[model samples]
Target: MFWWFERSGEHLRLEVLQLAADKYELRVIDADGTARVETFANADDLAKRQTQLQHALSSQGWTGPHGWVM
Candidate 1:
């Protein structure tokens, strides 16, 4: 899945990926091209972290998670 957040005309991207049957990754790429990657062992953990991330982003004034599954 892919998501986008925008702030002051800058865009940031988030990607959810399954690296293996039991391994998943959440990647956040900033508008400046810096990337932060986190791995999870299951969907539940990924979901929780995604929520936390969204809240943090929102607090930072990012205006969306406009997204789609890939």
Candidate 2:
């Protein structure tokens, strides 16, 4: 599953995808999903504000290896 959010005043969009394996893919897409800035990380720990947002997701709300807990 994926949720889409448009940045307040930009043409960019943030998409949060929930995968079957408990990981996640975040894409900063343009007006259209065709063009995007992509990043991959663990879905569990996905709320940290690290310098590298991509890395932050690797351990943010991590609970287990099979599914989301938070």
Using TM-score, give the best candidate's number.
1
Q: What are the candidates' C-alpha RMSDs?
A: 0.6, 9.9
Q: How many backbone clashes does candidate 2 have?
A: 6
Query: Residue 16 of candidate 1: its Cα lDDT?
Result: 96
* lDDT for predicted candidate 2 compared with the true structure: 0.42
TM-score of each: 0.97, 0.37
> Could you give candidate 1's per-residue lDDT for residues 1-70 as a string of tens digits?
9999999999999999999999999999999999999999999999999999999999999999998987
Worst 10 residues of 2 by lDDT: 61-70
What is the lDDT, from 0 to 100, of the residue 29 in candidate 1? 99
